[model samples]
Target chain A: MSNARRIIVINPNSTPEVTSAMRDALDDRFLCLDIPEGPATIVTDRDVAEAGPRVAALAAAQEAPLAVIVACFSDPGVAETRAAVPCPVIGIQEAGVAAALALAPRFGIIALSELPIARHRVRLERMGMLERLADEVGLSGVSAYAAGHDPAVYDELLAAGRRLIASGAGAIVLGCGGFGPRRAVLQAALGVPIVDPVLAAAGVALSVTGGQR
Target chain B: MSNARRIIVINPNSTPEVTSAMRDALDDRFLCLDIPEGPATIVTDRDVAEAGPRVAALAAAQEAPLAVIVACFSDPGVAETRAAVPCPVIGIQEAGVAAALALAPRFGIIALSELPIARHRVRLERMGMLERLADEVGLSGVSAYAAGHDPAVYDELLAAGRRLIASGAGAIVLGCGGFGPRRAVLQAALGVPIVDPVLAAAGVALSVTGGQR
Candidate 1:
């Protein structure tokens, strides 16, 4: 396959573990790039602001693949990256919500912490989809790092998922990219469609580019 | 390019004018197929019900292209077609709605007539997205046939688009495939995102299959 057909997924944060998890979820369908200079995890507005330029710069420096997926739920620098790159640039947050809308009408989010819930609310508000949102449940203090290594976080997610379902969400979206690996388990337990944003981005990229590789 | 990578867009209704309009909209990106035996237009539940098997059978008999887009906004036989085919099958309504959700929070539909509004409402309700709909405006008496031949139909569509915007729709979806050719004009005039479902289906198909021909 030509390099032009390749899809590049960039993790704005410097977490190799999260990058690896994303790569595993994609199963070698695309190239996965991690920014080693970014914070270990983006948990605050400051972290997101700091990572935005790095993500846009990295995307700008690439050789223009078929599509670029900014693999963060906050969609760090997505607009800037789109301005920087010639190919389509997809934000995982937007892709996840889009995928959820395709499968069902109302969707709920399971976030890593209260910070993302607030951030997500702002993002949804800007998109004019806050009305479509059923509920957003957060793990309170759970960090992506702890969630990845901790099995107990799944229970918390399940509890949150139940609450979202109770609130009338027909589908659930994992609000953080680090929650990618736990998607299948949560979907099975919750008995509803669970959207993994990275996968959703990959799907969108494949559809837009028409590159089967 | 392999034939397997080709995308076939099937118009469930047997309207050559609508099919030609769809082909023009796509600019020959995919193979456009029209069902010779289907109704002239899918307006009523009976028309949709009658077209289902034909669409499914046509889809099933194809040589398994990378993806298939059922070009009708009503998405008559999408599920049956999916069951019959191994590759991805996209419904224009689903694709359009998904694309709309990606760009904006709430979407308004500009339908061919009042008949499709009820059908669309039921479909949206089934998807669990009825609440996300800002409104659906119909060009009361405008048929696909009349819309294609008459430049005057654009006035009705423009009026409907403005009504949707006034009703707080952040985006507008051209509810019929025949409206495909008018997308740019409407978007320019309305100053909001307008989703042409056929193009949306093509985009979704390309993303899912990764086959750019």
Candidate 2:
């Protein structure tokens, strides 16, 4: 029997491509796991409203001490997960925002869409970083999850980062899971800290959860 | 023998006036126990550098799963107290930032001194609200642990809030323990959402600690 503790990373979306990308990005970071990796559940419902409770239920059913990561950029189920779990539970939005602040005095969030960008701005305000923000810019026509499997998704994200920096952003936050797979590439291209909310979120999950696996 | 859980709010400064002010402010909020009130502790250390760990050791000595609030504006021993207790440990800085974000899209922090203001800005960055700030203004020469008793201190704080609002702040955050004694007065004076970091921090400790009291 392997001794590695199980850690669950929940992708609050129905998309397999996004989940696959997240798995690949995080897999190398956990090479020391002695056992098979835990399940990565993708919510079939693309609806944001239903995502929280479903993910929370999944966490509740897993009988033992389990560290859970809500992989969505919106951090669906994060508050409920914290209330339900005995161990540490983290939301990507929470972890990502916290980590970005650690690296840069200010950061600009680059959301997948204009509508969500406003919502994200509210979210940041709720978190109390409004002054820390130089600005928040949205990618006008693209949504990370809606991009399907097109390689052009990556290019759009890279372009968005450049635009935010041009507007005087000290750091670029990859505001969605679809961008998780391209962190290093975008960071190199942007010449500034490209905050893959996923990586930062996951790193914090590891710290708070003490998830050795 | 009271079944109610006892929570100690340690002001971390030896000012009875601040302690009484904090007590009066919280008088109606917490449930009336057998004691009918929360216990308060104040640090005798008038010195800054010696305060942090000294207060931590005091919090470490409690026998029960007691919730302790390091009431100092600087949150002198919060991290060390968390290390010493299995229950929830909260810092006023962390709680205030988190709570203020819950209410407003942006808030300005009014601190005592420029050095302490820098420290608070760092804390907000750590809390992920660096970007949500409208401003961080300091009272010309007020000190966190020593300013609570002086009426002139309130004048400086009020001035700071005015300047913050002039710079486009939608809310105000009182960023020190010495300022806790004046939360209500400041809140009314500013006519904005004035977040008293002490109360915000205490509420978080209560939520996470699952206080039986």
Candidate 3:
């Protein structure tokens, strides 16, 4: 059997919705691990990256196999976390990308702001997936919950999607956490695949970890 | 700004190559979290989906915040994990689909085997992303490494990809860990966006959890 003794989930953002959404996404998938008594935890501090080392140090004291997930879109302490922990560490973005590649040949990214394109590019390169990226389209200075505030964001999303599809992208990844609820509307309009990182990461984690407890 | 203290990464399979690839994918670009110190760990072994909850229970003991990632494709312990931990947990497949939706409009999942199609579909449903799916094409009964073991398998992959694309798939995902090294080659032939789950998951993880640790 797999020996993942413990897991820690860190939400870098202060927003409870994102954290809760992430939590809800993984609810009830690993029933077997519970019967055997496994462990999992969630951290809600926006400052996890800098403090990550201290956390890892504490987790190491448990003397069991552990896995850590940087739960924010920014993945602050991923490297430091890796260096601090002897076991493997993963970020949801990394896990999401890996899982996406497993299912799709090409994919696109939807961002909340236009400026993050550079950041997204850098991320793809770091992950060695630049070549596979068809495009990175921004939602044009909107918050994750922009759709709720402005119904027009949906139209903007659709228009942006057309541009990405024209650019030869086959799949779309919703960059903002707020877009999760809009997936159905967008997917129907785009008539293509749309990926929400939260959901994608949750699924891949389950598969790779195989419902560890 | 975030206060997550720990994170866990669980790998469902025993293969070291997969683990190494996962590690390499997140080697750099962890600074998204905006924190300097982060902690992480990787778990290997354990099969079937039952092992996740046991692992998560162990993480709940820490006083700090935590994030958990299931590194396998099946998303083994997500359900139990959520119940076990007070923090958020993510899976690679879940993260992957989210990222893919951001980039592509329609994506096809070219998986390693047919047996997992139903499971993959179920995962898609859980994420509320079933509509984004164009197709779930299996690679004609092949293991991830089978392509490398024999050239014929590579040809089969190519053939499967072509069929998927023709069937209205705009992008592809490399569904297995064995396909890690072949992403570039597949992209070259497909001329469309492809989602590498590992890469996507890592990137999204970094973005969500805060980058550059």
Q: Each candidate's TM vs. the true structure?
A: 0.64, 0.49, 0.45
Model 2 scores a TM of 0.49
The 10-residue segment with the lowest total lDDT in model 3 chain A? A30-39
Q: How well does candidate 2 reproduce the true complex, by DockQ? A: 0.05
Docking class of 2: incorrect
Candidate 3 deviant stretches above 4 angstroms: A1-213, B1-7, B28-47, B54-66, B144-152
Question: Model 2 over residues A62-164: C-alpha lDDT tens digits?
Answer: 6554357677777667778767776556566655555444334556777666656666666666665666676666665554544334577777777777777
Q: Tell me the lDDT of candidate 2.
A: 0.59
Off by over 4 Å in 1: A1-4, A27-29, A146-149, A211-213, B1-71, B75-91, B100-213
- For model 1 chain A, the run of ten residues with the poorest summed lDDT: A204-213
What does the interface RMSD come to for each candidate?
Answer: 6.6, 13.7, 13.3
Native contacts, share recovered per candidate: 0.15, 0.07, 0.01
Give lDDT tens digits, candidate 1, residues B144-188.
Answer: 656555689988988999999999887777888777667767666
Best by TM-score: 1
> What is the C-alpha lDDT profile of model 2 across B11-86, one tens digit per residue?
6655455666566555332321111122232222234445667666766666554456666656666667767765
* Backbone clash pairs in model 2 (N, Cα, C under 3 Å; residues 3+ apart or in different chains), count: 18
lDDT of 3 by residue, A97-200 (tens): 54445334566777766766776677667655667678888776775446323588888888888888888876677765446656656766786556565555
Candidates 1 and 3: which is better by DockQ? 1
